[model samples]
Target: MRIKTLLVALAALVVSSFAVAADYYVDITNRTGYTIYYMYVSPGKSKSWEEDVLGNDVLMNGDTQRVTLTGYTNPYFDIRLVDEDEDSYTFWNVDVSTQDIVVTLDHLD
Candidate 1:
């Protein structure tokens, strides 16, 4: 009877462990009429940008990519989008928690 109770307690603990807050994922849309070769997202208060989230994948014009922001609790972020020609578009202090992102030429840094 003790073993059965222990197993039930363990099962409840396992289920509760997965109930943490969901990570924020923002969809970024490319509207700059250029193919983006790299993308970076960093916390708004940070001095430097983090790793390129796009990796080897490119975001073509009019394409949308979902950026996963894991382990970050801040809602504001600085996003950078680099094109094939190395031109960068930067958006600073963007509220990424509530809305999606749309990158355009007006965002050129």
Candidate 2:
């Protein structure tokens, strides 16, 4: 009887471990003087830039925007930021799942 109970508990633990999913997030810090008018997030290896993740939003100087990324567990990503002057910077191969990400758009001069 005890052996059967132990087996059941072990099975439950295994199932729960598989169920565990860590929430992914990114916080972009705008340190540049210019207003960041758009933001884009895409898989590191993807050809397309995808949608504007910021969507009608602007990230200003000293502002921080935290976005929770769902449905993807990809370890790497490409992040892009566009300033008011329409200049864009694409930082590639950023390992999202492992990065303590605070992408500071420091300068565009």
Candidate 3:
């Protein structure tokens, strides 16, 4: 049964190898009429929003911004959008790993 055990181990190794996480590309779209001052993306497991993903530029109304994030432990991501009036909107546990995600900020009213 040594050969059988070896085959099972090899299979497990191959499966585990495929489990390695990949980078995720996300587009933040502003569907709201207000100008988006900043967009924050952080790992879902983290306690805080790290920083504004839009470094030098602001995501204006009706504008879309592309961001690439790497090395997340889980598939879930947390997003926060800040408007010009300092109003904040939070989206929790967004799944962005498997497919290209468009995080749209829409009018609350």
lDDT (0 to 1) per candidate: 0.90, 0.77, 0.76
Query: TM-scores, in order shown?
Result: 0.77, 0.70, 0.74
Maximum-lDDT candidate: 1
lDDT per residue for candidate 1 within 1-109, as digits (tens), equals: 9999999999999987774544778899999999999999998999999999999899999999999887775678889999998999988898888878898998888
Clashing pairs in 1: none
- In angstroms, how far off is 38's CA in candidate 1? 0.7
How does model 3 score by TM-score? 0.74
lDDT of 3 by residue, 1-109 (tens): 9999999999999998876677776777787677888888898888989899888788877778888888755777888888888877777788876544343444231
True-structure RMSD, every candidate: 5.9, 4.8, 3.4
Residue 14 lDDT, candidate 2, scale 0-100: 93
- Tell me the lDDT of model 3 at 73: 51
Better of 2 and 3 by TM-score: 3
